[model samples]
Target: MLYIQLTPFPELHTERFVLRRLQQADAPALLDQRSDPRIMRYLDREPDTTLEQTTALIERITQNAADNSGVTWGIVRPAATQELLGTIGLWRIMAEHHRAEVGYGLHPDYWQQGVMSEALAAVLDFGFQTLKLHSVEANVNPHNTASRRLLEKHGFVQEAYFRQNYFFRGQFLDSIIYSLLTPEAAKPELINEAATEL
Candidate 1:
């Protein structure tokens, strides 16, 4: 079994952004992202319509980290502002299998900027190097082409497609599963190349 420790709350940094712990003060920014239809369209979850709901979501994310079940980071451009531009995380961790699922969303304003690419690379490194995870997977809405491209660009390959497997908002939705395993010694330049391209 894999040993996990989230007590210190890992904070990751890249050239342009910082992935830090989500805090109560981030509720407003988080609400903006979660409520925006463009960002939440493929997320399946209902838009967070109020601060109370956003706050509750933050609490849950915090608890998940506290329990060592997951870790989420508020993506912030520290050089310009402390406001959150998006959120990303590794959740549903399966310690015994040394795996976890990756999830993320960015504000529409930051779209197409490669911000997520950099953030994701940092997180992937942490998962494989620090956490000793063997693999990481992502579940994406089939219609979310941008997300699909992002995962693919980061070395993830499509492993499965489930038809109408997720029920949400009175309709069934299809999902695509993408997965990436730790790079072998011979192929040492996996995520690093992707990160540098951004």
Candidate 2:
């Protein structure tokens, strides 16, 4: 296996967005996202009610990268504006296993525009090519049809079904796990999908 460095942040670019490290200035945008019901629909945690919480979250993400355990990026489009539209990241990174769990959150206003599809394509490329990961997984609420469709578009296969095994906001939620192998991470169709308007 070829070894790859997982530490030290790197910036990624897509046709319409830039994926980069979370910064203090991003707290407000993150706070807005977390507080929005539409954006937090399937998320496990409560809405971030304060900028301090968002700041702390950013700090933890930075520390996780430093420890080589995880990486998170804020998605921004330069020509459109500096405001963040969403976040994408790898969590529970098990280097020994050559795999990681991926997660993302986007403001509802930007949904169905292909923005996330674009951002995730770039992230998968970094994971498979740069980080040398064998596979990437995503866990989603079964009811999150949009997220499921996005994963499917990128060649991710449903790998597991956990019925009511997760509790969020006082309800037991069914979760589905989806995975994409490194060999299939960057397919031509996915690249084409990323170019669509977002």
Strongest candidate by lDDT: 1
Clashes of each: 0, 1
| lDDT digits (tens) for residues 65-160 of candidate 1 | 999999999999888557888889997789999999999989998999999999999999999999999999999999999999999999999999
**Cα lDDT computed for each candidate against the true fold:** 0.91, 0.87
- How does model 1 fare in lDDT? 0.91
| TM-score, cand. 1 vs. native | 0.91
Candidate 1 lDDT trough over 10 residues, lowest sum: 183-192
Q: Taking the tens digit of each residue's C-alpha lDDT, what string does model 2 give over 1-198?
A: 435455668889999899988888889989999899888877777888988998999999998888888899999887744688999998668888889999999998898899999999999999987888989999998888999999999999999999989887688888899999998446888767878845
lDDT over C-alpha atoms for residue 9 of model 1: 90
Q: After superposition, how far is residue 6 of candidate 2 from its true place, in Å?
A: 4.2
Worst 10 residues of 2 by lDDT: 1-10
Instruction: Please name the candidate that would achieve the greatest TM-score relative to the true structure.
Output: 1
